[model samples]
Target: MPVPVVSVAQMRQWEQASWSAGRTEAAVIARVGACLAAWLRRHVPHNDRILILAGKGHNGDDARAALPHLQGRAVDLVEVRDPETALPDLERALARGPDWILDGLFGIGLNRPLAEPWCRLIERINQARSRIVSVDVPSGLDADTGRPWGATLRATCTLTLAAPKQGLLHPAAHTFTGRLEVIPDIGLVPCPIQSELCWTLPEDFLDWPPPRPVAAHKGTFGHLAIVAGSTGYHGAAVLAARAAQRARPGLITLITPASVYAVVASQLQAVMVHPWSAAHPLPGRYTALLFGPGLAAADLPAEIPATLARLWQEANVPIVVDASALDHVPRGPIPRDALRVLTPHPGEAARLLGTTTNEVQSNRVAAVRALSGQFGGAWIVLKGYQTLIGRQHGPIFVNPSGNPDLAQGGSGDVLAGYLAGLCAQPPLQGDPERLIRYAVWQHGAAADALSRRHPAWVVEDLVRTLGRVAPHRVASTARPATPTTPP
Candidate 1:
C-alpha cells in the first residue's frame, strides 16, 4: 500500500489500531528500538559518544527503548522533563559534548511554542557541534504545521516512524527534518486507516508502454494541445510544448495568439505551433489539452471561458488546466464525466481556493485538497517544494524528489506539458492518475539529477534530461516524425 502522511490525530488512531490488533506496548517499543539501533549501528560511528535527551512522553520512550542496542557505546541519558530541573543536566550534556545527540524531547505532540528553558535547550542543540538524529520529529517543531515553536532542533537526519508525518514533509520543515528516513518495519501495519496526505515515491511511475510494438506509430502515443502564451510570456508556451514532446506524445500543438506566434513557433521543432485565431474556433482533435501557461488579461477574453465550458460539456478528453486557466476550472463538485487536472502554484492555488498564499504554504497538504473540493478536478498538482498532487476527495500525494534548483519560473509549464504528453498516450489511457503522478515524479527526478552536476539550470534544460531520467518513456521507440498541421 502507498504510504500515508498522517497527522497527529490520525497517528494516535494508527497506534491505537495497532494495539487493538494484539500488539503489546513492549513488543512495539522493542521493534522501534531495534530499528533505530540498527540504523545507528550502520551510520553512527562506533567511536562517537551518544547523548540521549530523553523526555517523559511518547517520543522520549521511543528514544530510551533503543538504549539496549548501543550497549557497549558511550551513552548518556539525561531525563529532561521540567525546565528548572533539566537545566543542570542540559548544561552538563552540552559541556560533555557528545558527538551524536538523539533528540526525543517532543515529536508530533508539540503544537504550541516552546517554553523559555526548552527554547534555550533547542537553541543550544542548534549551536552544538554534534550531528543529531531526531526521533519521530525534531523537538520544538510543530509536526503538523512544519513551523518552529521558539527554536527547533537542526538535525542531520530524522528517523521518522512508519510513514512520514505531514509537517515533516513541509518545505519549511526541511531544515529541521534533515534527510528524512522512514523506519518501515516498526511492528505496525498501516492498513484500515486513511490519511488526507501521502508521500509519493519514484516507484509511483508504474513502468510504462512495455517496449513498443514494431508497428507503433506517432498516433500510438497520443496528441496534446497547449493553449498557452501571451505578448510577454511566449517562452512558457514553447517550454510546455517541448516538455510534452519529451513525454513522447505523438503530436503537440501550441495554440497561441498571433502576436506571440513568431517567438513560440521559431523555438519549437517537433511540436507544431498553430497561431490561434478567435474566428477559426478552438481545436478539438487532440487527445489531451494543456491551458494557461503564460496567459494575461489579453488571453482570458469571454471566449476563453465559453470555449472551456463548451469543451467541458462535449469533450471526453482529459484537460490539464494550469497557471491563469486554473481560475476558471469547474467550481464546487465537478461533473461525474469531467476529467480535468489543475496544476497551480501556491499563489494560483490560493486564488482558486480564496485563501492567502501564506495560509496555503503553511499547510500545503490542506491547500491541495481544498483545491480539489473548491475548484473540482480529477487531479490538482499544488506546485511547490515537494509539490503536492491531490485527487478530488482523495489522498494528497507529495512528491519526494526534486531540489530547490527547480524553483524557477517555467518549471510548472514543463510539468503541465509532461503530464499532458503522458495523458495522451496509449498505456493506461483510461486511468491517467498513475501516468499523471509519474509525470510529476519524473519532472522532479530530472531536476534532481541535473542539480547534482550543475549548480544552476533553467526550465528548457528539463526536456533533455527527461530522456536520460526515464529513457523508457522518451526513447523507448523511434518517435514518429515531427507532427504535421492539425486538421
Candidate 2:
C-alpha cells in the first residue's frame, strides 16, 4: 500500500511509539541525516560549496548531523542562537556565496509565524544567490495546512525525513518546497492512523494491468469507445485516440460529429472512426467509454445528454467523463455496477459544483472529496498541480508527478483517454481506485520525462511518451523510471 498522510500530532504520537520501542531521537536523527547525505552525494557534485543555516529546533539538528558525511566539500555553518545577535555571522556566510544553502531553521513543530529578526533572517537567506535546499518543512510553512504561516523562504529542493510531510504535497506548497525527495527508513511509518490521502509511488507499476500473454489477440484487452469532437475541435478527438492507442487498448472506436469526422479520420490509422447519429447515439458493445473532449455546447444538440444517457442506461462499464462532457454527465440514477470517472480542472470543477475556482483550489483535498459526494463519480480526478484523485467511498490519492509541462491545451483530453484505455484492459479493472491512480501517475510522468527534451511540449509529445510508461509489467521485466530527485 502507498504511504498515508501524517499530521504533526500523528508524528508526535509516532515519536512516542518509537520511543516506547527503544528508538531514541538522536539515533533517528543520525539515520535521517545519513540517508540525506547519501542522496546529496548522488545528486550534488563533490566540489560544490555548501552552507548550513542551523536553528535551535530538531530540523537544525538533522542538518548538523549530515555535516560528518559531507567531509570533502567546502562547508560552513551559521548557527542561529539569537537572530538579532547572529546577523553578522549570517552576513559573513551569505557573503561567501556558497553554491548550495541548507535551510534547517524549522520543521513540523512550528505552529506560529516567524517573528522579528527571524523573519528578516529568512528574507536575507532568500535574497542570497545560491540554490537553497530545505531540510524538512520550510521555515515558516504550516506542516498540516500546507500554507506559509509567514516569512517563508523558497527552496530549490526539499530533502524530507522518513515519509514526506502532507503539507509539502499541497499544490500551494510547491513554490516553497521546490523538488521533493523522501529520505526513507528513518523509522517514521505513516500508517493508516489518520489521513485521507496517499502518495503514489513508482513501485505501483509492478503487477498492474498485468502482462501480455504473448499469444494475446486484439479482443483480449477489450474495446474503448471515445465520444468526442466538433468542427473546429477535431484535433481533440485525434489526440484522445492517439493516447488511447499508445495505452495499448485492443480496439478504439472514435465517435465524432459528421462534419469533423473526416478530419479526425485522416489523422489516425488504427482507431475505427464513426459519425454522431441521433438515431443510434452509441452503437456497439464497449468495455469502457471516454467522453467530452473539446465538445462545443453550441454544436451539440440540446437533448444529446438525455439521448446518450437513455442509450447507455443498462451498460455496466467504466466511463471517463472529461472536458466539456463534465457538463453533460448522464442525469438520473447511474447503473448499479457502472464506474464513472470524472476529470475536471479547477474551472470546470467550479462550474460543476456551483462554486468559485478559488474555493476549489484553496483546499483541493476538500474540493475533491466534495466532488465525489456531490457529482457522484466513482473516481473524481481533480486535475491541477499535485492532482488529487478521490474515490467515491475510499481514500483520496495525491499524485506526485509532472511539472509545468502539463499546463497545455490538450493534455486533459489525453489523460481522459488514458484513464478509459486503462479501464478497458482486462484484469486491471478490478481495482477502480488504484487503476485511476496508475493512469493519473503515468500521465504526469509522461509529461515529466518529455519536458526535459523540450521547454514546452505539444499534447502529441505526451501521447507518445505514454508508450514508455504503459502498464505491461511481466514477471522478469521492470518498467523504466525517472528518479524522484531532480537531475
Candidate 3:
C-alpha cells in the first residue's frame, strides 16, 4: 500500500488541527522527541558520543525534550542562535568528536534562506565527519521543492515525523537525505489531499500474484503481446521478451519487424516470435499489449496509428507505451475505455509535451501531472532518479527501490516488459494500476538485489535476478485489505 506524502503547509495544518484538538505543542514535541530517542537507542550504540544541536523553534523544543530519554549516552547539548557566541561551545563539542550529531535546527516550515549564524552553523555541521541525523527535514532544505537554501546539512539518516514530505522524495534530495524513516506515532494525521507521493516497500509484494489455486494452469495466468524492436535494435525485443518470461507470464508473443524475427527468435525458446507485416494481424486474445522498445518511427507502417487504435478499441486491454513508440502516440485525448500507461524518459516526455527536457526535470511533479491530464486519464511513468508513477486521478507514487545501477541501456525495455508481464497475470490483469506499480517496484528491487552481489550488473543479470525477488510466498486467506485513498 502507498503511504501519504504532504507539503509543509499541509503538515502545518495537521499540526494546528492536532493542537486545536487538545494536543498541546509540548505534548507533540515530547512525543516526537521520545520517538527519536527510541530510534537512536535501537540504531546507535550506547557507548557512542552524541551531540544534539538545538535551535530556536518547536524543533529545538523537541530536541530538548528528547534529552531525558537518552540518559545512558555521553550527550552534549548546544543551543545555537548566534554563531559567534556558540562557536566556542560548538567547537568544544566537535573537538570531543561525537559519533552522531542530531540536527534539530529547522522543521518542515522553513521557507526563507538561512541567515549568517545558521548558515555558519550548518556549514560547520557539514564539515564535520560525524554522522548527522536530522529531525523532520534537513536544516536548509525546502520541504516543498526539495531544494537546498544555502548550506544544507547532509544527513546520514532523516527520521521524518509522521508522513514523508514531498521534497524528500525529489531526485535532488537523495544525497541530503540518505536513509529516510517515518515515525508514525508522532501525533500526525493524514492531510486531506487527493493524491500523495509514497515510498514503495518490499512487503507490498505479498499478494503480487496471490495464491495460485490448485486448479490453475498455464492458460490461467493470461498471455502478453509485445510489439517492439527493429532491424538494428533486435536486442531490445529480446530483453523485453526475456524479462516478461521471467515474470512468469503464462504466454508471451513477440511481434517484431521481419528483419529481426530470426535474431529475436534465436534468443528465446519460451516466447512465440512473429514477423510483423501489414498482412499479419496481431493476436486478438492477448491480455495486454506492450508497444515500443527499439521500434523506430521510420520503421513503422503508415497504418500504424489505425492498427494501434483498432487493437485498443477491439481488445480493450491495458497498453503500455514506451521507447520509440512514444513518438507515435495519438495527439487527441486517450480513449475512455482504454487502460493505458506511458513510460517515458525525460527526453521522450519533453517530446510528447512539446517542451524541453530541462523543463521536465526541473519540475517533475507538474510535468507528469500535465502529461496525465493531456492523455485524459493515462498512467504516466516518468523515469528518472526518483521514478514517478502518476495516474489521472491517483496520487503520484515514487519508486524508492532503484539505484544508479539502472542508468544503463535496455533498463527501460526491461521495465516495460516487466509491467506488461505483470498485467498479463490472472490476479493483476484487471487491476492495471496495481500491476504497473508492482512491476516498477519489482524492476527496481531486482536491480537493487543485483547491485549488492555485483558492483556493476548488465541488463541480462537483472533479468536473471528477477526470480529471486519475485513473490513466491502464499498469502493467508485473510490477507490485509488493499489500501485505498479516501474518495
Candidate 4:
C-alpha cells in the first residue's frame, strides 16, 4: 500500500475518526505501543535495557503503555510532569548510560517550547552515549519544521507513528532523526482522516511515459540533445550523457566543445557525440535540450545565454536547465510555454528565487513553486533532503527515497540525466504532469534501490546503477512486437 502522509491537522482528523468509530484513543495508543514493542523485540535484541521518558500527554501515554509489553526486558519509566523531579528515570538513564533511550514525550502537535526538566533531560539525551529511538517524534523538536525548542534529544532511530511527520525530513531534524522507520497501527485503520503529505513510492509512479511498443524503432524513443561539457568539466557531461544513454538507447546525442570531444566520447559508449566549435550554438535538431553539467563558467565564444535564448526560440521541445546554465539564464517572464524542466539544489534554488539560502531552506515548498512560476517550466525538481517535484498545475510530490549518503557532489548531474530519459519517454496518456511525477519517483526509486544494497552510497555509483532502476510497465497485447522483413 502507498504510504500515507498527513499534516498535524489531518492526523487529528484521523484520530477523531478512530475515536468516533468506537475505538478509544487509548486503544489507538496501545496499537502504536504494540507495533513499537514487536519491532524492538525482533530487532533490538534481548537484555537491551530501555529507558522510556513518559510525558503528560498521549505521546507519554504511549510510552507507559509499551512498558508492560517489554516482557522480561528491563524498563526504566520516567514520568515528566514537572522540571526537577519529573524526569528522574530519564536522568538516571543518562547518568547510568543505558543502551537505548526511548523518547515518547511529545508528538507532532507540540507548538510551544519545552520547559525546564524536560528541556534538561532532552539535552542530556542529546549528549548521551546511548542510542536513542524516538517514538513518534523526538522530545523538544517541532514536528512540522524540525526546529528544537531550548534543547532537543538527538535520536539514532525514530519510529514515526501512522505517517511520517514533515519534521523528520527537515534539515534541523536530520541529525536527530538518524534512520526513520514508519509503522502502521491497525487500530488507526478506521480513522476517517486523509493525508496531506504522501511518501511517493514506485507504485505511485504508474502511467508515466507509457509502456513502449516492441515494434517501435529508435526514432519512436524520443531524441535528446545534450549541450554540456567544456574544456575542463568533461566528466559532468560524460556522466549526464552516459546516464541518459543507459536510460534510453540510441536516442541521445551529446554536443560538446571540440577540445574535450575525444575525452567525453571515449568515456561513453551508448550516447552519440557531436563535436561543435566552442563558438557556435548547438544545431537545432533534437526533441529536447539538456544543458548544464560541465558547462564552462568562463565566457563562451557565442555566450551561453544568447545560445540558450536562440535554442528556446528555435527549438520546439522540452529544455532542461541545470547547474551553470541556471547561473547564466536571466530571470523574468518566460518566452513561451516550453516544456522546461529546471533541476536546482537549495543554493541554486535560492538564487533562482531571488532569496537567501536560509529563506529557501525555511520554506522549500514555497521556493520551488515560486521558481517554477518564474521559469514557466512544465516541471521543476528542487533537490534537497526531501526532494520536491513541481508540476505546472498539481500538488507537489515529496520523495521518500535517498539518505544523507546522496549529499555528495555530482549527484545532481546524475538526476539531470535521469530526468532527460524520462522526458524522452512517450507519455502514458499524453499527459506531461504524469511524466514529471514518474520521473521524479523513478529518480528517487533508483537511489532507494542502491541504498538498500549499499547504505553508504556515492554519486558515481548512483550514476552507474541507473540501468538497475526499472520503469513502470504493464503486460498487454496492444504493444506486441513485430518482425522486420529484409526487402
Q: What is the lDDT of residue 47 in candidate 2?
A: 88
Model 4 worst lDDT run, 10 consecutive residues: 477-486
The number of the candidate with the highest TM-score is 2
What TM-score, computed on C-alpha atoms, does each candidate reach? Answer: 0.75, 0.88, 0.81, 0.78
In the range 46-101, model 1's lDDT, one tens digit per residue, is: 98889988898878888887787677888888898876798788779878879999
Please name the candidate that would achieve the greatest lDDT relative to the true structure: 3
Model 4 segments more than 4 A misplaced: 1-7, 21-27, 34-56, 61-99, 109-113, 144-146, 164-203, 206-220, 277-285, 297-304, 328-338, 391-393, 428-434, 441-457, 467-487
For every candidate structure, what is the RMSD over all alpha carbons to the true structure, in angstroms? 9.3, 4.3, 5.9, 8.7
Residue-level lDDT of model 3, residues 327-406, one tens digit each, is: 76664566566778899999999999999999998888888888888776788999987688886566777766677889
- Tens digit of lDDT per residue, candidate 4, span 57-99? 8888877777666768877777876657665655666676577
- Candidate 4 residue pairs in backbone clash: none
Residue 104 in model 1: lDDT? 85
Q: Give the lowest summed-lDDT range of ten residues in model 3.
A: 478-487
Q: List the residue pairs that clash in candidate 1.
A: none
Error of 1 at 112 (Å): 9.2
**Which candidate, 1 or 3, would have the higher lDDT against the true structure?**
3
Candidate 1 lands at a TM-score of 0.75
lDDT at position 422, candidate 4: 60
Runs of candidate 1 with Cα error greater than 4 angstroms are: 7-13, 16-118, 129-133, 142-151, 155-157, 166-185, 206-215, 278-283, 297-306, 328-336, 353-355, 359-378, 467-487
Residue 396 displacement (Å), model 2: 1.2
